[model samples]
Target: MEQNLPVACVDLFCGAGGLTHGLLKKGIQVKAGVDVDPACRFAYEANNGGAVFLDRDVESLTAEDLASYFPRGSYSLLAGCAPCQPFSTYAKGKDTTQDAKWKLLRSFGDLVRKVQPDLVTMENVPQLPKHAIFNEFLEAFDGYHTWFEVVECKDYGIPQRRRRLVFLASKLGAISLIPPTHEKHISVADVIRDLPEIKAGETYPNDPLHASASLTEINLKRIRQSNPGGSWQDWDEDLIAECHRRDSGKSFRSVYGRMRWEDVAPTMTTLCYGFGNGRFGHPEQDRAISLREAALFQTFPKTYQFIPKNERANFTVIGRLIGNAVPVRLGEVIAMSIADHLKMVNKAEKKAN
Candidate 1:
C-alpha cells in the first residue's frame, strides 16, 4: 500500500547514493539527493534509479528547494546522515564545538521545521547523542513521535562491526526501527570470499575498483607476519615501528593488523585502504583489503560503480566515499522500519474510519 501512495523522499547529504539506493530497493521513491560534493553526482544519479542529484550544500538548502522534489499529496520523507567525522570516536579529545560542521545539524533541524514532512530520519555516530546539537535537532520534531538508538550493523546482517545511531521521527502516531533481521552474524568470508584474488598494488583488469594500495617493503613484511585477528605484537621486534615501541603508542593495537575470516570486519574508515590503517589487512593475503572488498564490507552491491569509466580510480577519493556512506544494508533496515511504521499507521486509520 505504501507503493500505491506516492511515498517520495529527498535524501540530504546523499553521498554516492547509498541510502537512496537502499530505499529504492525497499520500494521507496527517491525523487532527489542533495549533496555538496560534485564527485558524488555521477554515482548518485547513475545508480539510484535516475534520481536527480542536486549539487548544493545542506546549509544552503531551503524548504522550497526540497519540497519541489516531492509530488503533491505524496508522503514526503526527508532523510540524511550528516558528516560524522567531527563526532567520531576517532575525534576524541579534539574541540569540535567550534567546527562549522557542527552547525549542519542545526540547518537540518531548521529545514524540518519549515518543510514539516510526514517523516524524517537520520543516521550518525553513536557519540552524537552526547552533543548539544543532537538535542537541538530533536527540537525540530515537537509534534512528532521520535525514537533513536545505537544499533549494531552486524545484527542487521551487515558483515561489519559498525555501530551507528539511527533516529526516526514521524507525524504518524509512533515510530521505531524494525527488529534485527539476523540471529547468526554474517562474517568477513561470507561476504568477500568469492571475489577473485589480486596482489597488493595489482588491479584486476576487469574491475579497476578492485585494485589494492601498494605496500612498501617493510610494511609488506609486517603484513606477512600478521596473523588473522592478531596485531603488531605478532611481528618480530625488528619489524616494529619506532612509534609502537614507545609506551604511548602501545595502546594503539589495531593498526597493522589482519581481520579474522570467521568474524565481522572492524569498522571501515576513510583510510581503510591502507594496510596500517586499523586492522584492514587481508586475513590470508599479504596486503590490505582492496577498495572493492572495503565496499563489500560496507554492504554495497558487488556491481556498485564508484567512478566513471574514463576516470582513473583515486583510492583516497573513493575510499572516503565508501567509508562515509551509510552502509547499504543499514539503509535498507531504515527504509524497512519506515515501511512498517507506515503500514501500522495505515491500518489504524482504516480501523478508525
Candidate 2:
C-alpha cells in the first residue's frame, strides 16, 4: 500500500451512525454504513458526510459488496458492533446461542476473513469476552496484531456509566486504545442541564426528539416524590408496586429512580425514555428523561437528526437507536488510536526503507 492514501471505512450494523459520526469528527472518511434496519438510513446518511447507508443484513453481504464501498487503492477499515442482546447481561444466562443475532458476530468474522481489511474494530457489551463465540471471532485476526479491553464509558468522557468491549486489529502492526480522556468524570448535569425543560408527554417545540413519554397519574406522583440519586424506596409507601413488596423486588431498586445531577447516568437502554424502565427520571424535571436527553447521553451532537421531517417520533423506535448507539466520544477515541497506530507504522517503514 502507498503512503498518503485515504483510509476509508465501512461500518456494519451502523445504528444511527454514532460510530461513523465520531470517526468523521476525528477526520476519518467513512464511506458507507450497512445495517438491516431501513429506519437507520435517514439519520446515517443525513448526519454523516455523504456516507451511503446500505439497508442490508450483514449475513447476506459478500466481500465484493463491501470492497466496492472503498476508493480504489485506499486503505480499508471494516468496523461493526453486532447486535449484542444475546450477549448482554440483560439476557440473564438463557441459552441464547441459538438466537439469530448470535450468528451476526460469526458473520462479521467471515467478512474479515474474506475482505481482509487493513484495519478492523468492533464494540460490544463487556460480557462478550467470556463467551466461546468471542474466541471464534478473535480467530479471524490470526495474522493481525490484536488488542481489546473492557472500557468504562465514563472514563472515556461519556456521561453515562456504560461498559463495552473495544477491539482493534491491524495488519500493519500492534494497536491499542488511547488512555481514558476524563478523570473527574462528566456529570449528567454537564450534558443536559442547558436543554429546555418540558413536562411529561410534552415535546419541545424546537425539537421533536425532545419529547418525553407520558406517565400515568400514579407514576407522575411517584416521580414527583422521588429524589435525585434515590430509588423508588424513597417514594411514599402508597406508590410502591406490588413487585417491590416481595423479597425479589428489593434487588431491583434501580428502576423508577431519578438521575443525580452530580453523577453519571445508568446505561441507557432501548426503553430509557420511560421513567419506569430504569434510572431514567430527570434530576430536576417532573418527568422521565426525554429521547433527546438519551441521545445526548450517548454523546450525539445536539443537531443530530433522528426522526426525519414530517415523520412522527416513536419513542420505541428512536429510543432503541439512541440507546444502542456507540457513544460518539468513544468513536473519536477509537479513531485516534487507529491514527496513532498508522503514524507509527509509517515512520517504521520509512526508517526501514
Candidate 3:
C-alpha cells in the first residue's frame, strides 16, 4: 500500500473508459478495460492513452483472462459498473430477476471471488442496492471491509444531478468514497454554455460530435415554446401531446423540458440527445443537446474522442456509451479514496512494525 508499491486496475464492463480515464487521472495504472461493445474500442483506447480495451463480455471472462493483463504481486483493483437498466426504476414491474442481465452482477462477484483482488468497486443506479443480486455481490466480499452509499454526482463536481449507488471494498481495511469536492453544485451553463450553436440536425464544422439531432417541424415548434426548468405544463394547450390530456398522463411531466442554465442538468439517459427523452432540450437552442454536450454533462472531457476522424458520428451508439458511462469526476473521487485508504493502511503497518 506504500506509494512506492505498484497498484494496477482492470475495469470490467468498461464502457467507453469513463472510470478508467478517472483512475488514470489520479495516477492509478489501469492495465486494461473489458467490455462486449466493439463500438467502444475507439473511444476507450483513444481517450485513455495507454489503457488496453478488451472487447469481450464479462460472462465469458475467466480469472486467467483478467490475470493475463495484470502484473504478478501488484496490488490489484477489480472495478465493474455492470449495466444498470435491469435494476433501474424505469424497469419496474418487469421481471428483472428473470432477465439475462440480472446474472451479470453474479458473474462479476464470481470473478472477484476467483481473482481475490485487493480492492473492488462498482457504480450503478441508486436503486441497485435493493435487488437480491446486490446482496449476493456483497457476500463475495466476505473478508473485506466494504462501504456503499447512494451518492449525488453533483456533490463530486459532476455538472449533472445523477444519483448513483457506489460500492467500495478493500482487503486492506475500511474504505469509502472521497468527501464532496464542491459545496456549490456545478450548473449547466458552467459546462456547456460556451459551445458554438448549431441548428437541429446540423453538425458543427469543426467538431463532429457537436451535431444536434434533427427535429421534426412539430418538435421544433414544441422546443421553441419549452421553458428552461419548466415541465410540459409550460407548453401551449394546443401544443400539448394527446397523452397529456388524459388523467393518467398528467403525472408524467418531466419530458420535453429544457435544462436551466443556473441548475445542474438532470441525469443523462441513453436517449438524452433527443428532446422527447427526459428534460434534454437545450436551454437557449431550439433543439435537444448535442452528443458532445451530453458527454460533457457525463463529465467526459471536451476532447474525449468518440469516433475516428473519418468516421461519421452515430447517435445511438455514442449516446449509449456516454449515458451508460460512470461520470469521470465520480470515478476520480473513488480512485482518490482508494489511494488514501491504501496510504492509511500502509502507515498503520509501518507504525506497528
Candidate 4:
C-alpha cells in the first residue's frame, strides 16, 4: 500500500509457487500463497524464499482473514486461480453441479470484492467461460478493466505446449498480458535433453536431481507400443481393450503417446504416469515419463527443494503437484506485464498530481 513498497500478490490455489516464482522475478513482492495440499508447503516455502505458503482450501477464505494479511487497501493485488478440474477437458460432459470446485470461481470473485485490491488475475482452462458460475463472476466484477484470452505456454517461452485461459483485472485502468516472449518456440530437448538417462525403474547416479517413477510390466509394454506424438491407434489391435472397441471410445485419443524431441511437450496432467492418461511417454526413452522429466516439462528449477527425497518424486500426490503447477516461465511473463503496468500507473499519477 505504501508508495515506496513494491506491488504485492496473494496467490490463491498457488501450487508449488510456480506463478509466485515468476512474479517474484518481475519485481512483484509475493505476500503469501494459499493451497489445500500440505505437500506443497515445503517446496513452495523453500524455493520461494520470503513468501508464506498456506495449506488451506480457498472455499474457507474470509474477508476478516484476508484483511488481517492486508490492511485497508494495503494489498496491491488479490490474485486467485481456482483449481481447473471442474471445467477441464477431462471432466467433459460429466455432471459437475454438485462438485465443490464449481464454487471456487465465484468465491474468488467474492474475495476480490472483499479485498478490493488494485489488481487481480486468474488462470484456468478455456472451457471455464462456458460455466454459469464463471458468467456470474464476470457480472459481479464490473467496472474493473478486464481481459480474458486462451494463451499457449510455449508462446511465452515455456518448453511445453500447454494452453490456459488467463484473466487480468485492474482498477487502475485496462491491462493486457504480454505477447509471446520467444518467436522460436522452445523445444523439449532445449530443457531436458542434457539430463542423464535412467532405466525403467532407475534414478540417475551422478545427479541427485534426476528422478523417474518406477514402472510396472504393463506400463513398459505400453510405452514400447506407443509412438512419439502419436496415439493409442498405434497399438496392435489385440492390445486394444473392449472399451476401445465400443462405440463410445473412438474419440479418446492421446493415450500411450510419446513426445517429439524437436517440439514442445504435450500438456502435463496429474496422471502423467498412466500409459492411458495422455501423451506422456518419454520422447526416446523406453518408459513413461519419470519424476525429473515431469518437473522439467513444468519448468521448475532443477535445484528446487522438496521434503523427503527425489526417490519419492513420483508418488501420486507429489506428481500431481508438479504436473498441475503453473509453468514458472509463463508465470514470469505475467509478472513482468503487471509490473510494467504498475510503473505506468505510478507515472500517470505523478504527472496528474
Candidate 5:
C-alpha cells in the first residue's frame, strides 16, 4: 500500500478543504493549494497537511506553478473544482451568467489543458437537466478518456441525500471512480446527537468548535413556529409574512424550516445560517441550525476541531467555510477512488511487463 501512494496533489479552489482533508486521510500528499477565498486560510491549513495556500483565483494558476507542486518526474494528478454557484439552477431566473464566477471553470480547464496531469478530477452541483455548459465541457475533453457520473451521496456512505456530479479522467491509464461503499446510511442524529445543547446563538463551553450561532429575538420567534420536518406552512396566518400570503411567496416554503432527526438534512447552502433560507432549523430547538450542526450535517466528523489555542471560534467565519466546503466525507470518496484507480494501473503495467 505504501508503494502505491501518489507523491503529491495540488488542490485548486481548495476552499476550507473538505477535499484536502479527504485526500490526506487516504495518505495522498497535498503539496500546495490555491483558493480566492481568504476565509479558508485558517481552517484549510489548520486541518489539511499544513499546506501553503495561495489566495489567488484559479485562473491565475500557471503550468509551471502546477508542475512545481508535483514530484520531479512521476505520476502527476491535478484536481480542481471550479466555483459552482453560477451554473446552479436555483438562480435560473437571476442572471447567473452576468456574474464573473461562471467563467471560472473554463479558466480551470485552461490550467488543466496546460498542465495535462496524468489524472484530473472535478465536482460540481448537478446543473439541472438543462444548461449547455456541461455538454460543452464534455466536448472540450473529446480526445481524453473521461467518465462523468452523477453520484448520490448516500450511495457512497455519506448518509446525506446529496446528489453531485463528479468527473474523473486519466492519461496514466484507464481509471474509474471507486465503487460505492454503500455500507449503511448515517442519520441526522447519528452525526449530531452527541453534541452538547446550545440555545440559539450559544457556544459550547469546552470545545469552541462545538459552538453554535446565536439567534436574534425575532429569529427565535420564527424558529418557534417552525416544526421539525415542517415548512413555513406550519406558521399561523398572523406569523406569516405579508408576502407569504401571496402566490409568489408561497413557493418559498422550504425556508425557516426544521430538520427531521430521523432524516438527512437538505443541501446546505453558503447561507445556511439564515433562518429564512433552506430547511435549517434545529430539531426540538427554537433556532436555526448551529454552525457546528451544519458542519456535522455536511459530514464533518464531530471531533473535527478547526481552531487551536490562539484562535477564537467565530461562527460566522467557520459557518461560511463549512457550509461552502465540499463535504470532507465526499472528498474521501473521490480520493480513495483515485488511489484505487492508480493501484489498478500499476498492477496492470506490472503484469504486461
Candidate 6:
C-alpha cells in the first residue's frame, strides 16, 4: 500500500470503457478491459489511450489470461460491472434466474477467488443485492473487507436519476465510495442544452451521434403537444394511444412524456433514444433525446469517441452501450475512493513502522 507502489486494474464486462476511462482519469493504471462485444473494442481502445481491450466473454476468461496483462508484484485490482438486465426491475416477476447472464456473477466470483487481487469492485442494478446470486458473490469475499450501497447517480454529478448498487472490497483494508460530490442534482438542461439542435430523424451533419430518431406523424404531434414533466395524461384525448385507454394501460403513464429541463432525467434504458421509451422526449424539442444526448446524460464527455469517423451512428448498438454503461462520474468516485483508501493505508503503515 505504499504511495509510490504501482496499482493496476482489469475491467471485466467493460462496455465502451466508461469505467476504464474514469479509472485512468484518476491515475489508476488500467492494463486492459475484457468484454464479449467486439463492437466495444474500437470505442474502448479509442477512448482509453493506454488500455488494451480483449474481446472475450467472462465465462471463458481465466486468471492466467488476466495475469498476462499486468506485471508481477503490482497491486492488482479486479473490477467487473456484469450485465444487470436480468436483475433489473424491468425483469420483475420474470424467471431470470435461468438466463445465461444470471451466472455471470458466479463466473466473476470464480475469477476473483482464483486471481485474489488486492482490491475488487462492482456496480449493478439495485435489484441485484436481492438475488441469491448476489449473496453468493459476497461469499466469495469471505476473508476480505467489503462495503456496498445503492447510490444515487445524481449525487455523484451524473445528470440522470439512476440508482445503482456499488460494491468495493479489499484484502488490504476497508474501503467505501466517496461522499456525494454535488449537493444539488444536475438537470437535463445543464448537460444537453448547449448542443446544436436537430429535427426529428435528421442527423446533425457535424456530429452523426447527435442525430434524432424519425418520429411518425402522429408521434410527432404527440411530442409537440407534450409538456415537459407532464405525462401522456396532459396530451389531447385524441393523441392518447388506444392501448392507454384500456384499464391495464392506465398505469403506464410514463410513456410519451418529456423530460423536465430543470430536473435530472429518468434512468437511461437500452431504448432511451426511442421517443416511446420512458420519459425520453426532449424538454423543448419535438423529438426524443438523441444518441449523443443520451451519452451525455450518462456522463460521457462530448469528445468520447464511440463510433468510427466514417461510420454513421447505429441507434441499437450505441444506445445499448450508452444505457448499459456505468456513469463516468460514478466510476471516478469509486476510483477516488480506492485511491484515498490506498493513501490512508500507506499513511498508517508509515506511522506503524
> Superposing all C-alpha atoms, what RMSD in Å does each candidate have to the true structure?
2.0, 2.2, 2.0, 3.1, 2.8, 2.1
lDDT of 5 by residue, 34-64 (tens): 9988878877787776577889878777888
The collision pairs in model 3 are: none
Question: What are the runs in model 2 whose C-alpha is more than 4 Å off?
Answer: 1-3, 87-101
lDDT of 6 by residue, 1-353 (tens): 23567789999999998898888888888999999998899889999988999988798887889887667767789997988555334444555556666778888998898889999999988888776677778888978999999998898899888889999999988788889999998999999999998889989888889989899999998998889998888889998999999999999988999999899999998899998988999999899999999999988889998898968999999998988888888778888999889998888888899
The models' CA-based lDDT, in order, is 0.88, 0.90, 0.88, 0.76, 0.74, 0.88
> Candidate 4 — what's its lDDT?
0.76
Off by over 4 Å in 3: 88-99
Worst 10 residues of 3 by lDDT: 86-95
Put down candidate 1 lDDT per residue, 62-92, tens digits, no spaces. Answer: 7888777878978999999987555444355
lDDT of 2 by residue, 85-193 (tens): 5433445545554556678998999999999999999999888887767888899887999999999989988998888999999999999999998998999989999
Q: Is candidate 1 or candidate 4 better by lDDT?
A: 1
Query: Among all windows of ten consecutive residues in candidate 4, which has the lowest summed lDDT?
Result: 86-95
Task: Write down the lDDT that model 3 would get.
Answer: 0.88
Candidate 1: deviation at residue 333, Å? 0.7
Candidate 4 lDDT over residue span 9-105, tens digit each = 7889898888888787767778799998888898899889699988787778886776655644443777756875543344545555456757777
- How does model 1 fare in lDDT? 0.88
Q: How many backbone clashes does candidate 2 have?
A: 0
How well does candidate 2 score on lDDT at residue 19? Answer: 98
